[model samples]
Target: MNAIIDKLKMLKYVEVTASWLFANAKGRDAKTFVKSPQFASYPEPTIQITSPDCGASPATLSPEYMAGGDGRLPGLEWESVPGVKQWLLICEDVDAPLPNPICHGLYLGISKDKLSVTNSDFKPENEKSTRLNGGFYYGTNRLWIPPRPLLNHGIHRYFFDIIALSEPLDEKLAASKPTREQLAKEIDGKILGWGRWIGQCERVWK
Candidate 1:
């Protein structure tokens, strides 16, 4: 599938025309992920989320973190919020040609003491890196999935959102590999604060 998309992207006319046609269909801002019954009452992002490797919001994400490269998670740091018992990070691609932003990664069960996460947190099998220790847990999604935007789809925005929770999720709930719907039910009224950092990536036709 990727090979076919790569070939199509090489056709300049096809790339230009399709990109133009889909321009308005790039979907809503990735922040829309928070527009749920669970988060509707929370104020706009108050915490500051930043990536040491990606620099800052609107930064160009390193190629190594994209799907075609190493697919490693980037190191990220965020301001700690008072009364935060747990943290959740969810990365979404807002520019995908879909009704909703596509989730690239979702992590939960982060301990209150963990204000930042290094790329190593995603590499449990590597000898140099420890398993996602200190109570971190993967949500329904895999530990992490690199963003795989369509070639010639123009620039895509990846939003890394950190949600501060007033309570830690029950261990039993985390073990169930809760889906988005399940999570919404569980965290409703528990959100204390939110923050987001964005990185951009695109596959251009040469």
Candidate 2:
């Protein structure tokens, strides 16, 4: 067992799979697994999420706007607000069919100077190096997976949760994109304020 763990530790991608298997084996409800309750537990909304990419809650997102399509991150703008040292952005599909919500993208430790993120910022090539010097860290969608919701899974609610932190993250925490649990744990009572936007998506064709 120790040997297996050691090997898994060296392979982050496989580690994600193994953990997912264990979490879903019992058939836990989607909400129970998809979200980290700790992260969900917050004071209240402080910053405002801007829909620089599209209109407020479109009726249905077309294919080209999704993973199966161009796979580009939509443009988004939000305020740095006050009383915060860094920011975090996460795009999640809470309505995913699986036990856990699918993470389309995650970025952390954004400098307060940013103010907004554009589609170009989501480019795959920017991956690790993007954060190496920008005082930020980007966590690629889990396993480089895109936000391709399976058709007939029902309309998915994608949330862009933007948070402001009271203090700068430690070197380790800011080094990479944090997992849901990690985000919850790290932000435990440390969040200053937050805001979010919801987008609806559904696959219409087979």
Candidate 3:
């Protein structure tokens, strides 16, 4: 009976491996996504985002910023360009196991007077304070949506994007939750500057 149990365990391992391979066979790997031309066509503004907490373009991510980690959003500082009235902040995982990349965070209605976000700004209990700062609305990414990419999927890249808009979003627009598609409608001709930072996270699932 013990020998039979061991054989079953081995078979289970093989099945898991096969499932992972099938899920990732389409070359949805991070390397290809980072280099994909679709990225090039997107608007890139001259603004910049940084963290007193992190170095510029560090390849590896700390567990504190990843899914299943402590989930403390690293504090961020950014610059604004001339003619900007507001900004949008977003974080996206380009290598999820799905038809499209997952949108982790989509924060809108950030005011021009604001230039930074702290770890506490992400706490759900602090809505009053968040709305008072860079926010007329703190859309999606209200929570720090960490990367939990499957190990077999290889390393995943999460992009933190900031876009400067020429004017404050309309009150009606601020009240509604906007998806990436909806946000694009307002941004198409109005963006003045863009800032971005990328981090890589990989899990050890097997």
Tell me the tens digit of each residue's lDDT in model 1 across 1-206.
99988886577667567777787788577346587767777647889888888797878877898888998787899988889999888888889877888777777788899999988775544433322554566666466778766667878988888999999999767755677667878888889979989888887756
Superposition TM-score, candidate 1 onto the true structure: 0.84
Model 2 residue runs over 4 Å out of place are: 1-44, 58-60, 124-135, 140-144
**What is the Cα-based lDDT of residue 75 in candidate 1?**
86
Best by lDDT: 1
Report, for every candidate in turn, its global Cα lDDT versus the true structure. Answer: 0.78, 0.63, 0.66
lDDT of 3 by residue, 83-191 (tens): 8888778877766766566777777788787888876665544544335333455554244576776655567777777777887787667656666666776666667
TM-score between candidate 3 and the true structure: 0.74
Which residue pairs show backbone clashes in model 1? Answer: none
Q: Pick the candidate with the highest TM-score.
A: 1
Per-candidate TM vs. native? 0.84, 0.71, 0.74
The residue ranges of model 1 lying beyond 4 angstroms of the native Cα positions read 1-21, 125-134
Give the number of colliding residue pairs in candidate 1. 0
Candidates sorted by lDDT, descending order? Answer: 1, 3, 2
